[model samples]
Each structure stands twice: as structure tokens, then as C-alpha cells.
Target: MTHRWLHLRLAAPLVAFGDVAIDHVGPTRDFPAASALTGLLANALGLRREETSAHQALQDRLVFGAMVIRPGRLLTDIQNAKLEKKDCGWTTWGQPDVRTGDTYDSPHRRRRDYLADHDCRVVLRLHDLPEGPDLDRLAEVLDRPARPLFIGRKGCLPSAQLFAGWLEGENALEALKAIGLPGRAFWPAEEGGGTVRDISDMRNWRTGLHGGHRRVSEGEIA
Candidate 1:
């Protein structure tokens, strides 16, 4: 079955594909997460943080696969900051996020992982739901986003326009192969054969937590 897919070029000097965090260590995965892509699209559509239902709905509708065009080096960033009861931080929405906890005497510290000089390609298509935005609407908004778009985090901005073009294939894996870029790829396990692995990437937007696992096939795609 031939299906049309939206192509995205996710290239950046520093990109962070989020992984399940423990303590002060925030790690990144080699490929983009389904929740991350869902957030990216929702942000392009100018959806606000309060719209949990919309975010959840969007995530449920996404079906995507990613290819690593450039296997970049891993970079770790050590960060520390001291905060008072009245300290506030700036957010992506251009507003101040006030601290609402007891003052801390010591500086808060954490380590974040990122991919330096990384480049990835993604092919995405929405599930055939009766409601919600379609491929055309998503492409249109990405071209002229309601808000500034970022690759993974607000600090990791894309170097080029994300809308890479469109292609048709039987599934996400075949669509990536159609691009002719050789690299490691990940796609739905049911779509084809590869090393089947369970990945925990989906998020429950309403609860603001990462839960559940999806099976995917990981292998080299030439």
C-alpha cells in the first residue's frame, strides 16, 4: 500500500533526543522520540502548555520513523544554578517561571546529554482518525509556524528549514529508504524485519510522565 509521508530534516549544532531521566542525569537517545516529535508539531501549531488533551491527541495520531544521517559525537553539559525563593526563570513562551519552593542553600546541579553536529531525517504520517489536523495542515504550519520551532529543546534550534519534502512508500521504513541516505534507521517493528526492541518513548501528556513501550525495528538502512 502506497502512503504519502511528510519528510523532515532535523539538523542542528546541538540536538537532544530525550530519554527517561533518573535523578540529575538527563540522557538523550540516538533517534527522535514519538513524544518529542508530537511536541514539536504542537508547538508549530501554537498550542499552549495547558492544552494537555490536544497534546495527547496529537501524539496518539503520529506514526513516524527516523534516520541518522550523521552519527554525531555525544556531548555532556554540566549545569549548576542557585535559586532563592523569589528567583524566576525565562521560558520559551517569553514569560517568567517563578520558583515556588523553599530556598535552597546549595546550587542545583545536573548533567544533560546532547548530540553535537547531528543531522537526522524523519518521515511522519498521521493515523486516519476521524478528527484532528491532516498532513497538509501540519506541513503548512511547519512552514510558517505559529511560534518559533526548535528541534528538541528550545536551546537546540534547527540550522535549516524542517520541511524536507514528501514521499510515498508502503511504510515509514520504506519511505526512509526512498530518501537514499545511508545510515542507521528505526521503524515500526510490524512494518518490516530488523532487530526488534522495545522502546519507552511515549508520554502521557495529561499526567506529564513517560510511560508505556512501543516495539520498533532497529538496523542499518542503506
Candidate 2:
């Protein structure tokens, strides 16, 4: 079935799109992942975490694409954190308070990777579903999200608007050029340049079994 694609822009001073870190370093992908984009859509629609049906239905027929307007700078920061046991009445984490809970002196060295001044044009190709939360509904939500939207992390918000409009043509590259943004057309690749290492699995966003992207090519939208 032919799908109608939506053109949106994900521009933020800083944005991080990656999975939980298995190592000591938390790295961000070059571009946003499909799951992350879907998460943005879900948030715009105000879908709950337990609403797997809504999430899955949207994932079933979706294609994600991106054009690099500003690749941004690769920056990693060293974060010193403590192993704590719950919060202290929203005061802060690891704050000593017998009324709340005892905190541990577990100092953890975490390396957080981020992209400064990152910007990109995201294309969301969604199928026409019947039950609920259709692409048309998503388009409306993007115009005026039920809740305020952010990029990937809460701290990182979009510096510019999110929605561009409906895609004009079928060609992905053409659609991107129509926006008139100046940037390179890069895609997922296994080797060399223009590759995106994504942790979000398009097949299953939760399990991530089919996750771990090798690379992204310009025309190939997975």
C-alpha cells in the first residue's frame, strides 16, 4: 500500500537519540532513530507507556528518513553520579535524608555523548490505518501537540519548529530538497561515511531484537 509521508524538522541545540548504554559511555546517533521519531509522535498524541497497541499499530507501517542540514559537532562530557535509592521527596537524587531513604556512595563515571547545534529534516511516511491514531491525526497533533514536545531528552528541546508539512512527491530526495534546506544527503551505511548507528528497532521498538542498525543509505528507508 502507498503511504503518505509527512515532512518534519527536528532541530535542537543538542539532541541525543540512542538506547541505554551497555558500556560506560552513552553515545548518540548521527541522526534520530525511527523509534525516537515514533516516540515524538506518540508524545504529540499523548499515548501512554502501557499503550503498546497504539505504539505498535503506528510502527507496523512507518518509514523514517532524514537529510543532514547541519551534522553538528560531536561532544562527549564526563558525568559524575551516585548510586541512589529513590528520590528524596523531589528534592534531588542522592541527597541525604533519613525521611526519604539512605543514599549510597556509589560514584559512577558516565560518559555522555551529544551533538551540539544538531539539525536535520525528518520524513515520516505513515500508512492509513483504520482503528485509531492515523497519520492524519498525527499531522494534526504535530501542528499542535497535546503536550509540549522535545527532541529526544527532556533537557534537549527543539530550537526551531518541528512540522514542515505534507510531502509533495514520492522521491525522498526530492521531497527533502523541496524544503530548500542546504545540507548533504546521507543515509545508513555499513561501512565508510554517511552511516547511522541506530539502537531503535523498527520491527520492535521495545524488545529491540531487530535493532542495532548497521548503516543508513540515502534512498533506503527502513
Candidate 3:
């Protein structure tokens, strides 16, 4: 039995609209990508650490979900792809709604159009391994960076589990075997990892791009 490790990448932080509200709000109150990530991980993986400790650790390490989106369509196209039952290679990780709010500026209008009604945005970005998924194609079509970070520092849950699956086409189990995770252990472990903690605790809401937000200045993640 092999266990598989799926690494989800998350952007920095930003504001997000949610039914729940935080104590005080500000540009800094933008979603705490790190904090939310920790909650998600704890819920997904069912870590043994205390809630507070896990939250702090996940935040400090800056771990979160990842998605590969088409370039100019980072906002709109990705959403459409997802809406159309197409996979953006998104994980069960956190993402904000990009259709609302007045805080984003992109060179491309398609992205603006898609995000026009959503209020959530990405902040920082985490890289994914090439073999992990082909966000490259999505990036190429958009003629922009393949991977994009959420700029809004916020959080919302849409029950979007399109990315979660029992398998990843073509016996990913074989890949896990090659990687040394026992096959029998793979599925259960992955499910456990994805459902480690309280989903609500992972809520985040922060928007507004600060000078710190950055795209892939280096070459794409081949």
C-alpha cells in the first residue's frame, strides 16, 4: 500500500467576502492565507496538533491550495473551466470568489469580466511540480503566467470539490508506488489529509493587492 502526498500551493493573502465577519477589518485583515491553510490542512489531514498550534504552523509555513489557470483568463476562464466541469487542476484547498468587489486590476479584461461578480481574490502563490498537473496549457492559452495567486486576502466556501477525486487518471497509484508510498495506504491517507480539521475554521477574507504580491518572475514551473 502506498501513500500519496499532494502538495497544494496557496497565494499570500487578501480580503474575501464571507457570511462571517472578523473583529476588525483592514487591508492587513485581508485573508490570512497561512491561517486558513492551516485550518484546511488540519481538517483535511486530521493532524494531531492542537487547533491553535496547527493554525499557527500552517500559516507560518504558508501552505494552501493550488490551481492552474489559463493566463489572461486567470479570473474568468478558470471559473468558466471549473463551471463547465473542466478541471483547473485545483485542489480541495481554499479559494475566494472573484466575481465581486472592486479591488482588482488586470491587464486583461477577460479576467476582469469573470471576476466582476466575485469578491474573493488570491494573494500569494505556491508552486506546483510539473508532473503534478498541466496548468501550463491553461497559462499558455492566456499568454500570461500559468499560475496565479489570490490577491484578495479573504475566504469563502463554495463546496467546490471538483478537484478532489478517488483517482488521478491512469493509476496514480503506480506513481505513488514509484514514489514509495504504499498503494493500500494512498487513498485513505489522501482522504484523511483533505479532511483533517474543521472546514469553517479555514474561512478567510482579505482583498487588495499590496506591492508584495508577485507573479512568477522566474521561468514557469516546468
Among the numbered candidates, top TM-score falls to 1
- Positional deviation of residue 116's Cα in model 3 after best superposition, in angstroms: 5.9
Q: Which of candidates 1 and 2 reaches a greater TM-score?
A: 1
Put down candidate 2 lDDT per residue, 190-214, tens digits, no spaces. Answer: 4234445434445364664444443
lDDT of each: 0.92, 0.69, 0.28
lDDT of 3 by residue, 70-145 (tens): 1211221212122322223345468633443333343222121122222222222223343222333322322332
For candidate 2, the TM-score is 0.76
lDDT of 1 by residue, 37-105 (tens): 989999999999989999999999888999999987999999998889998887777899988898888
Cα-lDDT of candidate 1: 0.92
Model 1: per-residue Cα lDDT at residue 130: 84
